[model samples]
Target: MKKLSYLFIALFSLSLMTTSCREQKSTGEKVEEAVEDTGDAIEDAADDVSDEVEDAVDDNK
Candidate 1:
């Protein structure tokens, strides 16, 4: 009976560890996605500024 109880406890602990690892991986993916999105936004803003400058120069001509 004691051996059975120990086996149950070990299985439960292993399950919990697996779940924790999956959660950590999910969190890491979300952070990577956010960083990529931020980089895209910065690139778009730079393009807009470049276009405005070109337009102003053309107007002067």
Candidate 2:
């Protein structure tokens, strides 16, 4: 029947939408974690550079 086809189509669209939404959420989480890792790396590098500068200054004193 025509009504049954419409119902099936609606259900299929809804399922697809839910799957896509879940995928987006997972991707967003991965991106956030990557950004955090990058920030940590940058901070570590900065700390290393600062330590080197301090050592050089101490040597001059």
Candidate 3:
């Protein structure tokens, strides 16, 4: 019974270690992420500008 308990504990520790050692993002992945974020920011800014333009047009009328 004690041997089995030790084996279980060792296995649990090993699994925890492996789970924490996740694969890091490569350079290409990082660049892709940055580009995606920039795209989202640009889209948001464009939406804000469109809204402002509509508001100004309504005011002029």
Q: Which candidate number would show the highest TM-score if scored against the true structure?
A: 3
Worst 10 residues of 2 by lDDT: 19-28
lDDT of 3 at 27: 100
lDDT of 3 by residue, 1-61 (tens): 9999999999999998888657999999999999999999999999999999999999999
Which residue pairs does candidate 1 place in steric collision? none
Candidate 1 achieves a global lDDT of 0.92
Model 3 segments beyond 4 Å from truth?
Answer: 1-19
Distance (Å) between predicted and true CA of 53, model 2? 0.2
Each prediction's number of clashing residue pairs:
0, 0, 0
Off by over 4 Å in 2: 1-25
TM agreement with the true structure for every prediction: 0.58, 0.58, 0.65
Query: What overall lDDT, based on C-alpha atoms, would model 3 receive against the true structure?
Result: 0.97
What local lDDT does model 3 show for residue 61? 100
lDDT of 3 at 22: 70
Give me the displacement of residue 23 in model 2, in angstroms: 11
